[model samples]
Target: MKEVKVEKLLINYKTLEEFKRFKEYGHQELSMLEDLQSNIVENDSESPFYGVYYGGSLIARMSLYKVDKKYDQYFEPQHDYLELWKLEVLPHYRGKGYGKSLVDYAKGYNLPIKTNPRVNSHGFWERMKFQKATYEMERDFGQNPLIWLPEGISERNTQ
Candidate 1:
């Protein structure tokens, strides 16, 4: 596989159109368009989303948002971490390591990472060394949380 260049997608017709390929395209996507047009965002704004393109086509992508330390409830040292979501690889590109590459890109931060494994994707998350956060009735209600910790950081286990 050729090198996949990961870039912060800009809000524009091309990008919007590219997103339509995603099943989860919805309000959040529209909001980005709206924000861009309304000048709420810079023309070339740096979005939290990062994606890898294969010769002008977006084959894999993921979003990693930084959560403030004040809201840090998952890690032991109580530091800021990334909330990873919307990690999707184009159906045609499945099994090509693109998804894992996107994940590996996120891990480049070496920060505590949290993600909700899509149904049946538990094995992938596990293979990536992400663990289910010990059930927290209040914090993790209705969600299966998977987390990856860098060295020197630990999960705040629930008793």
Candidate 2:
């Protein structure tokens, strides 16, 4: 498999246009566009989005946000963690490891990661060594979160 370079996408019209090709485009992206149009943010501002381009076209992407420890209820020791969302690969890019590569890049941070995966993606997350976090009504209402913990870390039981 060819190595795909994951890059931190900047907030720009061109980058927003490329995002339209992704299926997960929604409010977060719209908010960015609004910020750009209103000049509230400068072009090329750093965004939380990271992606892999194929032949210069973005073929896969994900949004990773860091949640401070004070807001963490998913792990033991109450440490900061990554909240990964909107991970999507173009239909043609499936099975080529583009998604996995992006995930691996996230794991390189060495912080515990959390993601509420889309329906039917359980197998992929499982294959990535993530396990379903025990659900808590107040903390996890309407979300089924999966988590990946680095060595010497474990989930806090919410049951």
Index of the highest-lDDT prediction: 2
The most accurate candidate by TM-score is: 2
**Candidate 2 regions with alpha-carbon error over 4 angstroms:** 24-40, 135-139
**Candidate 2 lDDT over residue span 1-159, tens digit each:** 977799988777787778766635443532333433443265566578888999999888888899999988878888899988878887788989999999999999999999988878899999999998884437666778889999988898766
Work out candidate 2's RMSD over C-alphas: 3.2
What tens digits encode model 1's per-residue C-alpha lDDT throughout 26-136?
A: 425323333334432544776776778887887677777888878888888898889888787877788888888888888888888998767688988988899988734
In angstroms, how far off is 122's CA in candidate 1? 0.7
Q: Count clashing residue pairs in model 2.
A: 0
List per-prediction Cα lDDT, in the order shown: 0.75, 0.80
- Cand. 2 TM to true fold: 0.86
Per-candidate clash tally: 0, 0
Candidate 1 ranges beyond 4 A from true positions: 24-40, 135-139
Indicate the residue-level lDDT of 5 in model 2.
Answer: 93
